[model samples]
Target: MSGATILMLVVGAIAIAAAARRYNLPSPLVLVVAGLALSFVPQIPNIELNPDLVLFGVLPPLLFNASLDSSYLNLRANVRAVALLSVGLVLFTTVVVGAVAFWVMGPSLGWPLALVLGAVVSPPDAVATTAIARNLKLPRKSLTILGGESLLNDATALTAYRVALLAAVGSGVSVVHGFALFGMAVGVGVAVGLILGAAAAWLLCKLSDSLVEVAIFLILPFGAYALAEHFEGSGVLAVVTAGILIGRKMPKMHYATRLQGGSVTATIDFVLETLVFGLIGLQLPSIIASVHDRSAAQVTLLVIAVTLTVLIARIVWMFPATYGPRKFSKRIRERDPAPSKAVIGVLAWAGMRGVVTLAAAYALPLTMDNGQELKGRDLVLLCAFVVVIATLLLQGLTLPWLIRRINLPVDEDQADALAEAQAAQQAAQAAVDRLEEIAEAELPTGSTIVDDLRTSAESRANAAWERLGPQDESRLETPSELYRRLRRDMLHQERTVYIQERDSGRIDDEVLRRVQRELDLEEAMLDR
Candidate 1:
C-alpha cells in the first residue's frame, strides 16, 4: 500500500470509530460499512498490508484487554464448563466442518486443504463475544464460560491451523510431535506471561506516576506476544495469561495515580478499547482487496456455505454439550439444578463470530503447498467476512430481545443498587467510628453527649440502608431520597456549567469535552 492510501485509511477509520461509539453500534460493523463505502470510490489505491500484522498486532492488545477485564473468580469457578466449550467445542466444530467440506468440496480442494478452511472458522471472536456479553448480563457462570472460552479458543484453533497447514506442506505431522508442541506452546506462554506480569505489576506498584503506569501497561501485551512468538510459543495465549494474572494482582496495587484526574487503569482501558476498535475497522480495505474478481455465483455460494456451517455447527454442538454437562453435574452433586432448555437455547444463539475468524481467513497464505496459487483464498476471506457480519449483526441485535422473551431471571440493577447502599452504610459507619475518636479527644467530657450523637449518625445511615431492604418504611422516613435529590441537583448544576463553557469562547472544544466528561462522571457517582 502507498503511504497516501495508508494515511487515508487511517483517517477514515478514526472518523468511523468515533461515529460508532456515538451511535452505540458495534465498531467493527461501522468499520466494515465504512470500508465497503470507501472501496467503491474511484482511485482509492488498493491497500495491501501484511495479514500477520492485523492478526497479531491488531488482535493481541484487544484480546489482552478483554481478558484483563474479565472476572477471574467467575472464570475459576466455571473452569470445567469453559474448558468444555472452548477446547472441546472448537475441536468438535473443526471435525464436523472438515468432514462436511471434504465430502462436499473435496473435488475442488483437497481433503487437507478443506480441513484448513474448517480450522480457520472454528473459534469465535473474543471482541464480538465480550461486546455482546457486556450488554446481556447473563448469569455469572454463563458469562464467565463465554468470556474465558473466547480468550483461550483462539490459541487452540490457531495452533491447530498451523499444524494442519504443516501437514499439508508435507512436514509429516506426528501425533506425538503435535502433542509435544501444544504442551510447549502452553507452558512457555504461561511462564513468560507470569514473569512479565510480575515485572509489570512490580513496576506499577512502585511507580506513583499515572502516565508512566499506563504506558507500561500498554507495552506489556505486545511484549508478551513478541516474547512468546520468539520462543516458539502461542503469543496469543501468553498475552491473555499475562492479562488475567495482572488483573487479578492489580486490586492490591495502588492504582491511585491521577491520569487526567482518574484512575490510571481505567484510563488505560478506555484508550485501549477505543484504539483497538478503530484498528479493527481500519482493516477493512485490505480484507476487501483479498477478493477482487469472483463471479456472483461463486461469491454467493461461498458466503452461503460459510454462514451455514458456522451457524449450524454451534447449535448442533452446544445443545448437546450444555445439556450433557448439566445432567452430569446433577448426577454427581445430587442437588445441582440443570439449566432450563430455554436458557441453553439462548446461549446457543448468542455465539457471534467476529475479528478472530476474519483475521485468520485474511492470514491465509497466498500460495499453496504445490506452489500453485491458492484458488479459493479470496473466497475464504469473503466467506469469513460474511460469517462475521451475519453473526454479529443478526445475533447481537436480537439477543436482548431473546433474553427478555425467555423470561430468564435477572435482577435488572436492583441488586447492584442494594449492594451500593450496603457498602455506603459500612463506609459511613467507619467514618462515624473515626469521628468518635476525634470527639472523645475534643469533647467537653460529657459521655451521653458523644453517645447520643454517634447513635443518631448511625441511625441515619442505617435508615438509608433499611429503605434498600424489603422493609415497608415510608420514602419520607429514608434520608436516601433527600441525598438522591441533592445529588441530582448538584449534577444538573455541573452539566449547566459544562454547557455554558462550551457555548462561550472561554474553552476550546477539546477542553470543554474533558470538563463535560468530568461532569458526567460526577453525575454517575451520585447513585453510589
Candidate 2:
C-alpha cells in the first residue's frame, strides 16, 4: 500500500472509532463494518494483511498493554479459572472443532488440515474480549478471568496450531512430542519474561526523565517478544509476563512517569485495535475471491458449521470448568466459591475472536513439503475469517444485551470507594510520620514547611474519612471542602490571568501555556 493510502485508512479508522464511541457501540464492530464497505471501493488499494506484522509487530504491544492494565492481585485470586479457560478450554476446543471439521470435510480436507483450522479459530481474541468486558462493566471476577485468559491463551492456541501445521506439512508430529514442545515453550517463555521484566525494571529505575522512561516501556514489549521468539519460546506469554512484572513495579516510579506511560499505552492500544479490526474487514474481498473451487453452498455450510462448533465448544467446556472442581474438593469450595450461573452464561457467550485468529490463518505456508499446494489452505483461511466475523458480530453485539438481561450483580462501587479511601488515609498517615521524623532529626526548631506538610496530610486523611462517614451537621461545610473550593477558585483566577495576558500580547503563547499548566496541575491536586 502507498503511504497516502495507509494514512487515509488510519484517518478513516479513527473517524469510525470515534463514531462508535459516540453511539456507545463496540469500536471493533464498527471498524470491521467500515472496512468491509471500503473494500469494494475501486480507488482503494488492495492492502495485503501481513501475518508477520500482525503477530510480531501488533500482538506484543496489545498483550503487554492489557497485562499491564490488569490487576495482578485479582489475577492471582482467579488463577484456577484463568488456567481452565486459557489452557484447558483452548486445547479442548481445538480437538472438538478439529474433529467436527474433519468429520464434515473428510476425504478432501483430511484430519491434519481440519486440526489446523480448529487451532486457528480456537482461542478468543484478547483485545476484543478485554474491550467488550470493560465497556459493558461485567462482574469483576468475570472480567479478571477473561482478561487473564486473553493474555495467555494465544500461546496455547498458537502452539497447537504449530504442532498441527507440522503434521499438515507431512512432518509426522506425535501427540507426545507436541505436548513436550508445548511444555518447553511455556517454561522457557516464562523464564525469559521474568529475566527481561527484571532487567527492564532496573533500567527504568536508573532513568529519571519521564519521557525517557516512557520510551523504554514502549520498547520493552517488543524486546521481550523478540528475545523469547529467538529462543523458540512463546512470545505472547513472554510479553504478558513482562507487562505484569513491570506493571507491579510502576508504583515505585515517579508519578509523572506513571501518568505519561498510561497515556502512551492507551493511545497505542486504541490505534492498533482500530487498524486490526479494520484490516479484518478489508480482507473480505480477497477471501471471497479465493474460494473459487468450492461451491457457494459448500462454503456456506462449512462456515456455519465451523462457526457453530467454536461457539458450542466453549459453552460445553465452561460448565465443567466452572463447577466441576467445587463439586469434588472441599478446599476448593471453601477457598474459591463458584460464580453464579448467570456469570457463567455471560462468560460462555463472550468468546468472540478477532485479529489473532486471522493472523494465524494467514500465516499458514502456501505450499507443503512436497511443493504442491497445501490442501484446504483457502478453506481454513475462509473458515477462520468466518468464525471471527460470526463471533465478533453475533456475540459481541449481543453480549451487552445478555449481561443486562441476566442482571448479574453490579460491582460493589461503595465498598471499592471505601477501600480506596482507607488506603489513602494510611498513606497520608505515613507521610505525616515521615515529616515528623525529618523535623526532629534535621532542625532544632521545627520549620514552617513541616507544619504545612502535617496540615496537608491531615486534610487529605480527613477527606478520605469523609467519603466513608456521615456528614458533619455542626458545620455548614467541612474545613477540607472549604479549602478545596478556595484553592480551585485561586487556580481558576490564575488561569484567567494567563489567558488574558496571552490574548493581550503581553505574554508569548509558550509562556501562557507554561503558566496555565501549573494552574491545571494545582486544580488536579485539589480535585483529587
Candidate 3:
C-alpha cells in the first residue's frame, strides 16, 4: 500500500473507533463491519493483509500490553483455570474443530488440511476478548481467567497451527514429535522472555526521564519477540512473559514513568487493535475471490458447520474443565468453590475468536512439497474468516446481555473501593511514622512541621475510611471531607493568583508554571 492509503486507513479507523465509543458499541465489531463495506468501494485500493506484518509486527505489542496490565498475583491464584483454558482447551478445540471440518469437507481436503483449518481458528483473540471484557465489567475472576487465557492461548494455537501446516504440506511429523516441539517452544520462549524482561527493567530503573522509559518499553515487545523467534521459540509467549515480568517490576520505577508508560500503551493498543480488526474485514474480497470449484451452498454449509463446531466444542470442554475437578478431588472442592452454572455459561460464550485466526490462515504457503497447489488453502482461509466473524458477532454482541441476565454475585466496583480504602489507610500510617522519625532525628524535637504533617496524614487516612462508611444525606460533610474541600478551595485560589500574576506580566511564564505545578500536586494529593 502507498503512504496515502495507509494514512487514509489510519484516519478512517480512528474515526470509526471514536464513533463506536460514542455510541456505546464495540469498536472491533464496528471496524470489521466498516472495512467489509469499504472493500466493495471501487475507489478504495486493495490493501493486502500481510501475514508477516500481522504476526511479527502486530501480535507482539498487543500481547505485551495486555500481559503488562494483567495481575500477576491474580493469575497465579487462578493458574489452574487459565492453564485449562489456554493450553488444554486450545488443543482440544483444534482437534474437535478439525475433525468436524474433515467430516463436512470430505476426503478431498484431507486430515492434515482440515487440522490446519482447526488450528487457525483455535485460539480466541486476546485483544478482542480483553477489550470487550473490560468494557462489560464481567466478574473479577472470570475477567482474570479470560484475560490470562487469551494471553497464553495464542502461543499454543500458533505452534499447533505450524505443526498442522507442516503436515498439510507433506512435511509431516509424528504426534509425539509435534508435542516435543511444542514443549521446547514454550520452555525456550519463556526463558528468553524472562531474560529480556529483567534486562529491560534494569534499564528502565536507570533512566529518570519518563519519555525515554516509555520509548524503551515501546521497543521491548518487538525485540523480545524477534529474539525468541530467531532462537526457534514461540514469539507470542515471549512477548507475554516479558510484559508480565516488566509490569510486576513497574512499582519500583518512578511514578511519572508508570503514568507516561500507561498512556503510551493505551494509545498504541487502540490504534493497532482498530487497524487489525479492520484489516480482517478488508480481506473479505480476497477470500471470496479465492473460493473456486465449490458451490455457494457447499461453502455456506461448510462455514456454518465449522463455526458451530468451534462454539459447541468450547462449551463441551469448558463444563468438564470447570466443574469436573472440583467434583472428583476433595482437595479442589475444599480449596476452591465451584462456580455457578450461570458463570459457566458466560465463560462458554466468551470464547470469541479474532485476528490471530485470520493471520495464521493467511500465513499458509501456496504450494506443497511436490509443487502441486496446497489443497484447500483458500477454503481454510474462508472457513477461518467465517469462524472469526461468527464468534465475534454472535458471542461478542451477546456476552454483555448474558452477564446482565445471569446476575453474577460479585460487585467489582464495591470490592475495588474497599480494597483501595484499606491500602490507603496503611500507606498513610506509614507516612506519618516516617515523618515523625525524620523530625526526631534531623529537626528540632518540638518542630511544628512534624505536627502538621501528622495531622495531614491522619486526615488522609480518615478520608479513605470514610469511603467505606455509610452515607447520610443529613450529615453530608464529615470532618475529613470538609478538610479536603477547604484544601481544594485554597489551592484553587492560589492557582487563580498565579494565572493573574502571569497575565499581568508580574511573573514570568516559567515561574508561574512551576508554582502552578506545585499547587496542582497539592490538590491531587487531597483528591487522592
Which candidate has the top score in TM-score? 2
Angstrom error at residue 282, model 3: 2.0
2 or 3: which has the higher TM-score? 2
Candidate 1 lDDT over 277-311, as tens digits, reads 34443445665666676567656765677678777
Could you list the CA RMSD of all candidates, in the order they appear? 5.1, 2.4, 2.4
Off by over 4 Å in 2: 441-448, 468-490, 503-505, 526-528
- lDDT for position 483 in model 3: 77
lDDT of 3 by residue, 185-293 (tens): 8998999999999999898888899988998889999999998888879998899999999999889998889877887999999999888888878888888889966
RMSD of 3: 2.4
Task: Encode model 2's per-residue lDDT on 134-212: one tens digit a residue.
Answer: 7786778888998999999999999899999999988988999999989888988999899999998887877789999
Q: Rate the local accuracy (lDDT) of all candidates.
A: 0.71, 0.88, 0.88
Q: Estimate TM-scores for all models.
A: 0.80, 0.94, 0.93
lDDT score of residue 346 within candidate 1:
78
